[model samples]
Target: MKNYPQAARILVAIDCIIFGFDGKEIKLLLIKRNFEPEKGKWSLMGGFVNEDEDLSDGAARILYNLTGLKNIYVEQLETFGKARRDPGERTVSVVFSALIKIDAHDSEAVRSHNASWIALDARPKLIFDHEEMVARAIEHLKYNAALHPIGFELLPERFTIPQLQKLYEAIYNIPIDRRNFSRKLLSTGLLIDTGDKNNNGATKKATLYKLDTEKYKANFHSFWNFMPDSMKE
Candidate 1:
């Protein structure tokens, strides 16, 4: 085997920014570090990559260790390789963004790792470069939510248009016009009226709707202008 004569030996790490929407607010899953180099501080669920594992597999393993769920919606957000990013070692971190249904995750798995879900806007100070990774994840969420149907990943199996609207509002931190919002979403033809109603809201019960599973899976990547102009860059 041939090796590069002057190749730098740097460690590789994978950190996940897990986002969830609980009907009304967007939240993040964070862990209270249990080891040195910032033990007890809020941090992302992360670990060093194993020598024989692939990048995505390593990310999935880290997420599973913290959430006890598999086959989740995960993507590589960015790679942070700042020389001094890790105070304890010279490591290049690959950040992943995962969207999950908050209620479906295993609470015991999170508890085992000293992890908790924090409202996105109310999160505490994070360790190392975790905060920056979270900010980038938020930007990615907002950007993709505007152009794709990815927001539905954070919602329940069945929900009303108002509930979906609130999810988007929470993601962008802005209120959407009710009338246009409903019309636009309906026009997508991705929602199937479930003949049910949401009896949980303070106001009158709203009709329940579920995704058109066939259409959703087929058109998940198509462009959809769901964000309000004010929220756009």
Candidate 2:
């Protein structure tokens, strides 16, 4: 192998900002660093990219290692390459943002990795520039949610209209009118009647619905003007 002798050495790291929805509020998956400069501090799930490994592959590997999940929605969020970002080394990090259903991940893997699903609003301080990475990921999530079928990725296979409304309220951190919200979602025709009710079997249980995934894929980029009046800037 040939190398540039005059070039400086640099390390590459992949960090995952994994978000989940637990039928209430948004949550972040964080791990307690078991080694290094800040061993006990909360941190995003991350790992160093291996020799000959692709960046996306490294991100996927890191996420799966922590959550025992695969084939989930993952997108490259940003690159953080500020000098001395990692006190232990001169490293550049590529970040990936993932949204997973809270009930679908492996509980054992999370416990083994010392990872916990912390509510976004109540998360603790994180190591390095991971806090900034999380803020940026939230921005991207908000942006994408306005133009994409975000619930399809984070919510369960079947959920009530109120559940969907609660998700939007959590993401935007604002109150939304329930009547208008339900009306708007039904107008989109993106939701399909599942002919089922909430599992608890409440007498007045809300009907459950699922995304019309086929229609979504047919016009994947067509979800527009989806934000409620309060959600818009």
Best by lDDT: 1
Candidate 2 residues lying further than 4 Å off, grouped into runs, are 201-204
State, as a TM-score between 0 and 1, how close model 1 is to the true structure: 0.94
Instruction: Please provide, for model 2 over 136-157, each residue's C-alpha lDDT reduced to its tens digit, 9 standing for 90 to 100.
Output: 9999999888787776688888
Q: Give Cα distance to truth, residue 127, candidate 1, Å.
A: 1.2
* Model 2 local distance difference test score: 0.88
Per-residue lDDT of model 1, residues 176-210, tens digit only? 88899999899999989888878876424898888
